[model samples]
Target: MSSNQRKSFFDLSASGQKKRLKAAQDVPLPGSGSQSSSSRREEDVPDSPVPLSQPHPSSEDQALGHCPRSDELELCPSASSSDEYEIEDENNVEDSSEESSNDDDHDDDIGIREKLRNWASQYKITATALTALLHILTSHICFSSLPLDGRTLCRTPRNINTVEVEPGHYSHIGLKSTLIKLMSGVSHTINTVILHISTDGLPLFKSMPGELWPILGSIKNVCSLSKIVFPIGIYFGKKKPIDCCLFLKEFVEESIDVINNGITIEGRKFQVLIQGIICDTPARSYILGTKSHTGYSSCIRCKQEGIYDKGRMTFPSVNAPPRCHEDFLIQRDLDFQVSESLLVKIPGLDLVKNLPLDYMHAVCLGVVKKLLLTWTSGPVNKCKFPSRLVNQLYSFVLCHNLSAYCSILGFPNTI
Candidate 1:
């Protein structure tokens, strides 16, 4: 070691005074003569008392002064051996400290991962948001081992198979697996899932002929609000499916399996019941293999014969005999059902009873709105309201600020 390094290393010991005494005895006078030795003793001893104002040399300074110089190589051989031992001790301490630091870094990484996952779940954060956050973190912090992609962090599957129901047409996402995933967290002993199925044709654009028909479902009496609606099947076509039964074949088969055998979730089997199938008049007619809404025997609830009115078919009877499941099974009315529906294959499903009239079509957007429009804007007859009454109604609507209802009435500008 250098002279400065040796001084610093020996300074850690409390034996500085003993080492100085030993060094003075071992180191002989530079010249071989009595005169030289007498001169050295005189130089070591002060001529007069050190002035109090000048201060005294500290122990550290004394230790440095007595430290062996490079030219006196043969004088002190033990100091070199002592330095090697201290250096080895320092190297071992450094190794252990590095190991401990590595462990701390690993724990920190786990903590960061758990915190991010909890934050994402609590806020229902999107993948894009997580990806942005990860980019910022990786740019500023040194965590190259952590996943950079949001999908990987979110644990999203990469190899999901898309089932094609028809060529360039429909796709079926497995219903059984979806149900298991959705209901896996339920803690009930006897789980009962009441499912509601709905389907409708969706026009993609007004300028294009392309359209989509997705079969969606929801679980009734489910506590979780986030998973209300899920897709079971979807179809893209220039027009509606050629055959309704073929379109619904996959869905019907799945429904039958779920209702009869039940599905296992988290090692517990859940009994699924088909609560209802909801659809508008046109969609309902298409799925049930019945005539269109304009047909004379289009009403699915009852066997009420429709009469030809001023411009269209109208069902005026309020107390018509209700249609039964037996009538549907037997195909009692030839005019009503054009073909058998695929829904009949499901064991416990009722074609007529289990199919409820959709609220959006049967009430809010259909009967009530149409009746109001007919009374206000129809031909001048008993159905048309008086001019004074129509003005009062318009004023009432304006006073209430019922813009949403007026907009749905399709007369926002006129009103």
Candidate 2:
């Protein structure tokens, strides 16, 4: 770690909010964010230019010193969810420099060292609360520049080998016929996986569930976050806006390979998010009450026509409502270039279930956070997406091509 990073790490054991703020300055920002020596005035600190860490907004409004916002709470990966659980763990940092080599390296020195160790133990407790808050802020700002999840599909003669065509859902798994046809129409094999995670979801190794099996074995890479919510949401059907970004992070990580190896397919793309709880789906209606459903609303990550929800309505589709917003399409061409590599029939719940809870939680939360943040935050600097980005166009073999797609499949209002 760089000196700045080292300081930030050390700040993990800081005492007061002031010390925490000072420590935050050490996490230098890149490019234009860093301040130039010439621009530095007597009061202007070196790290001010980047605005890497903004003063706590709440604190700015308080008297005298900072806002004294909710006394910086504890944010360790291992803590109870209740307010009391956020209490700082009493452990301080040892100032190794203070350890004297004198006392002829005898028992006296040992006593002095123990004294320092004890003091440091208490220091850690002092720092924990501040550290947690700062980390919460750091995680959030760190992921502000995330990209969108691009779901694409490109098909042609090479990958398609389906001879006998049936109307109703293919009864059997039809592994060979379907896989080959899917493969034949496929132009590539790699996929770009973006995994979005919330603040709480980062340390997934310690939390993911052990009940599921891996569907993609070893192919995973290239993830990012649209927002920084803590603690990912992994359990089946759980959804929390605070944890929505986690899902996007995972997919982005795996997407790099998808882009490199997979052929093109359809091009519709959406982000994912992990709710703090088990989210059923994002589709709102009488289902998602009035509170904006945040990450719980159906996102492209979980966007699939259920038994009959289909077509373009306001919320759109038979399954979920029309999309609240669609800002995750920056890399449409990449989507057009890689969507075909995806298995349309893959089990969403089952596949995600295999991941550790923390991992899955992070992925789900990250995706949701990013999408909502970007959309609600409104209008960002972006280039017009390429038209080719829509290549994931799927072809349906309708009994009578009679308006295979109904303009308005369901009644207006909620459903």
Candidate 3:
């Protein structure tokens, strides 16, 4: 029969019809009828291997408790059962969020401690010590009133009995009393006040031309160790005033009165005297109304004539008579001499004796530095030692185990 004319067993629903179809299928063809029934049964069964065509379990199905099996379709959980799992997951998420918040709070605490430690370490302080120091600083104990080494000098009981003087035209009255009060506890015996005046040009700005000439005064007895220079007056301008005596007129008048009539301090009379003036070369010349240090006759000690060579004026060591106050008075009419200087008018004061050589300028800077430069650099121009042999001599000194002493004298090892 043709394939289209064949009937299917599935078209009938009766059990007898299905049994007849099963028997028809079981009846073997003519060529395959020789096989035994047990062999046929074995052939009809499938091999016991894993099914390759089975669908995989999806992620959602596995989350809902489902298995990947064709015969187990009821393994998936119902909607009501899955609700409990979702609620549990939400609770776990809340727990995790709370744990993170707690961790952040702990981290914030750690960060605060770290910042405090860094702040203390920046000022070189330990944590425990810094806490104690802050407590002490904020306390109301008036620690500033406590006596310190150098700070307690003027505040001592012996120096406390002060006599306040009224303001005067030139200076504060009772100045002598205040000074004696400061020196009361000192061991040095002071019967009179010997004042030393100092003046210097202070430049106001580096690029500008203005400067200030300040006159300073200090007690001569205590000046060596405690040379405190108090400002008396300040003259400001680009150039020095033409008449310095006029600017110092009030000070001079007050000093004259103090010298003539002694000042009373704490009911005790103390005599005052103008000792001398201390200044550098330029300031000294300007104040004393003398020729500049570079002038032809610039030597204050003697009447030696200076020769101008190259760009500098050099004075030779000649045996010339020293100028005195009488000589200054006699030569006041001369064109070179300044007759109107207040220094010449001060009685009982010898200009020559009063004005001494400034050791720092004349000896240390001028002589010593010149000698060192000549020794090191071998007198390139207008230096004392014009020969290179001086440098060799210096090297020889260095070679002879005198480097230590040379270093003390400001001589470098390399040059």
Candidate 4:
């Protein structure tokens, strides 16, 4: 079957999305009204697997739950415990040498015995750190593996279509943020946002050093631009069969000229990012590190030092790496670098049909019901989106890791 065969309601499901996209022309789009009607149906809402030591029956994102469950760990692992080695078989993690190393990492994290009583309080984002580390490691193969077996920053690719939304770019308002904000007017609310980075094939996870290819994507949100770029939303409807490929084609070509040109913030000029994520509700936003010109891409280091099939060991030299800090402490998060947000809707399995608007609204409200933990509304540069918010968002994906990937077995995420 074609990769697009079982795509969801978002822009990916279109029959010819891939084949037709080549010359880097603008990816075609469906009118908001028509595409909304093209929403995919939810064929299934299977139980998302709960991670190690997490409560089951699951909520929005079971896979991400493990991050928070670390909260359950007693302050001291050696204080006195019969079950110190309790590895929940139900966690459903990949049984690999990698995971074994992960367990050791977890144990070492808990056993910092020189013990301090106020450690949790001293570390403001303890939960945030745990959430990021576990979620990135267990839930996303794309993120957990160290890039390049090391780290290599990637440089901007050549001739990526550029769009400058504002006159100048601000330090905080990188390209991705500018783009998402510019397209905000396109949708009343975004129900879902599918984020992926492209490479020639089997793209290396963001952590891998010097390993990358042009990272491309198709964002399906309520609004429709000529091509697939940031601000993906989806209304309820049956998306046209050709939308998938058409969108890819159009998106690859049309850079948000307005947003890309430049944004002068506080007098300094900066380029805008091409990619970003928007999965926040009234409380906060969880921005994925998909700035334009960023994300999965080949690096100069890789091109120069890489062997035919193997990657070279190069950290620190990896240019243009994803924005997030890769250390286990703060990996796999969705910090907005901005104010709080609200998630209006979240769809189910099939891309076409949504998980009842009311239901999604309730879910977002319930999880993020309390806005007490929001940021101090600091400037965007700090990603003031609040670590808690990012953790919650990661929780959404981590919780669904197994089930979601299982559904796409044919398209195993080689990340």
For candidate 4, the per-residue lDDT at 388 reads 73
Ten-residue stretch with the least lDDT total in model 2: 147-156
Q: lDDT of candidate 4?
A: 0.31
lDDT of 1 by residue, 135-172 (tens): 87887657665678778887888865444444337778
Cα deviation of 238, candidate 4, in Å: 1.9
TM-score pick, better of 2 and 4: 2
| Tens digits of lDDT, candidate 3, 1-415 | 3544433332335675546434644666466667975565344422232343556666565444333332332234345537877999999999999999889877765664455456665676654565565455436453332223222212224333222121111222233444655566555556787888777777789997776666677877764425665666556667665566665565566666677887765566778877888889888877777788888877777877788998998876677777777767667424345545676665556777888889888887788887777765654555556457666776777677655454344444554
Please identify model 4 stretches exceeding 4 Å from their true place. Answer: 1-230, 233-236, 248-260, 273-415
* Top candidate (TM-score): 1
Worst 10 residues of 1 by lDDT: 45-54
Task: Please give each candidate's TM-score.
Answer: 0.63, 0.15, 0.49, 0.14
* TM-score of structure candidate 3: 0.49
lDDT of residue 233 for candidate 2: 16
How high is the CA lDDT of each candidate model? 0.76, 0.30, 0.61, 0.31
- Badly placed stretches (over 4 Å) of model 3 are 1-181, 184-188, 223-225, 333-335, 379-415
Question: Over all chains combined, what TM-score does candidate 1 have?
Answer: 0.63
lDDT of 2 by residue, 1-415 (tens): 4443223222344355356656444544345366753443222333222232344434233322333221242222222333333343211122332344333455644554455345535565344453343345346644222211111001112332222111111011221222223334334434432332212211223364322111111112322222222221122222222222232334333433333344333552223222122323321111112122232232333342323233322233455433221212222223212222121122231222322233233454565555544543436445323334322211122222434554334332210
Error of 2 at 406 (Å): 48
